[model samples]
Target: MISFELLLGVAIVAGFVGAMSGMGGGIILIPALTLVGIDIKHAIAVSILSIIATSSGSASAYARDHITNLKVGMFLEMFTIIGALVGASITIASSTRPLYIAFGAVLLGSWAALLFAGHASWHASTQDGFTRWLELEGSYPDQALGETISYKARRAYYGAPAMFGAGLIAGLLGIGAGAVKVLIHDLIMGLPPKVSTTTSNLIIGVTALAGTSAYLAAGLIDPGLAAPVVLGVVLGAFLGTRLLVKLTNKAVRRFFLVVLLVLAVEMIIRGLRG
Candidate 1:
């Protein structure tokens, strides 16, 4: 087994990578924790801690740049928050190994969706019905080029369902929820990549808060592991934010897919092996 200091070192590296990729620290940290003798349940609890740290640490920059679409985030967050609460309350568990198989499938789906999902562009907001009621349309500045990229939500009703689904997955898996949130923002909400990524970052903290309570109530939390992971995630997020744009788009997508696949496989093997 690796020493605690060594585990922290691994966490630091994972934190930097996850943050740079905008994948929240949990995505990377949970998998690493599994290798270090931490159970999946405990890993998830720690993941929640790490997510909060990275999100809080990074929210300011995204907000200051105006790349965070507060309107869309809050609107969709309503459903996500509700979903998280439900996930916390009623997630079925039967050896999460099979769950890992499902997770891998979803990760692959997320990867494929990103490959086909085009960059978000502008659209007119719907003037009628639930669209206006949700106030889902909005815009944000370009974090990369300092350009203001304004966009409107494409399908309000459809997007809400997607957000709700994303929230449920987040509640069950303890992921940052950005994987689905970013996709919805880009494809459904018509926000640019920078805006979607930043806004997702802003909203996940809110989502994690709702989910963490449930995870804790289920007796899944471990502060010893969570502390180091959160610390590592915060440090990594700083570095990742600095390099978010430096990596090529194709590279980012490909890397994200590969990483997801590995984690999925890891979870599957662990589930089956145990």
Candidate 2:
């Protein structure tokens, strides 16, 4: 059995990274748990739970600091919840290897796209009629830039469906799919990187909740293992939120790119080896 202290320590690191990059802690925690000899299904269940904790810990801080775009978060959440339910049900009866590889490929593509963009920041120069009607726009005080950054979200038609796909991956892999969500927010919706990360943080909790019910119904959640993870991630997430607000958008984008590249390669390798 993995020691409680060890799990707690890993969860803390996972949470910190998750919050920093807007990819829920599950992306880190699931792999660690599996490598430590825990069953993957159980690890996934616990990871999903920790995602909730991660969001709870950091989302409020982002929202309070006015970094989160609440209108955008709430709007995109509806599709993700539905996708999460369907994806969770599929995971119970399917092989995960293909899913892992496929998800990694998607991340790889996203990484390449972002890299090729070459530091061109996402600024919403125009909003479509639908986006404007929804009022999917906001401004936040940026500590790193020493000024307020305002942005409007566009391309809701593309972003909503893409979030469904993100939710599906989250439910299938217990990853919260925050990385994909962030990509969609930036690439499709034209939101700033900081806004994308913070808004992704706010949206992930609701998506996880939809998936958690499926796992709970299957009796996959082990409270004993989940306890320490939840506690540790919450603590780490709080720390991450404090630091993220102080960083520049470019710094956050760089961090996200690095993490996406590393995790995507690792997951693909694991899937191929299996």
Candidate 3:
């Protein structure tokens, strides 16, 4: 059995990465827990609970700093919630191999898309009537850039459905789906990277809440495992929020991509071996 201290340490690292990248710590936590002899299903459930802690610890700070776009987060939440419930239900009946493969596949796809999009030169999209009506635009003070950055979101019509897909993957994999959410915000909606990440942080908590119901109903939530993870992630997430706001967009993107690539390969290999 994994020692409580060891699990706490792992959770802390997972939380920090999750908060920094807006990819919920579950991506890291689930793999670590499974390696420690925990069942994937239970690891997933514990990770889901920890996601709420990560969001709670980090999202508030981002919002208070005005880095999070509340309007965009709210609009997208509607789709994500519905999708999360459905995805969690599917996970209950699914096999672990496919879940691992799908988790890795999604991360790989997001990494590729972001890499192609490039690190610099993020421009606001030409807003259509629909996007303009939805008012999916905002500005934030970027501590890294030392200026106020203003941006307009475009293609809400597409972003909504994409977010649903993100939420589905989140619930299915016990990841916050923040990576996929960030990709949608950055690529489809044309939001800035900082905005994409911060807003993703805001959206993930609610998505997790929706997904948690299914797990709870199925009696998969183990309080003994979840307690240490939640406590550790909250601490790590608090630390991550402090650093993320000070980092440059390019730096943040680089960190995100590296983590994604390493985890993607690891998960895929594990899935294939099974």
Winner on lDDT between 2 and 3 is 3
Candidate 2 residue lDDT tens string, 145-262: 8999888889999999999998998888787777689889988999999899889988999999988999999988888898988898888777876687422478877876887788
lDDT of each: 0.71, 0.81, 0.83
What lDDT does candidate 1 reach at residue 267?
Answer: 69
Candidate 1 local accuracy as lDDT?
Answer: 0.71
Q: How many backbone clashes does candidate 3 have?
A: 0
lDDT ranking from best candidate downward:
3, 2, 1
> Each prediction's TM-score against the native?
0.84, 0.81, 0.84
**Which regions of candidate 3 are displaced past 4 Å?**
17-23, 107-117, 144-147, 240-266, 269-274
Candidate 2 lDDT trough over 10 residues, lowest sum: 115-124
lDDT of 1 at 28: 70
Best by lDDT: 3
Report the lDDT tens digits of candidate 1 across residue range 1-274.
3467866786787888776665666667767777777766677667775777778677777788666778877877888878877765654354566555555565666556655655445454544466667665556655466676555555767877788888777777777878788878777766667767788887888888888888887777767666667777677667777776533577776777787777767766766776
TM-score for predicted model 3 compared with the true structure: 0.84
Worst 10 residues of 3 by lDDT: 239-248
What local lDDT does model 2 show for residue 223? 84
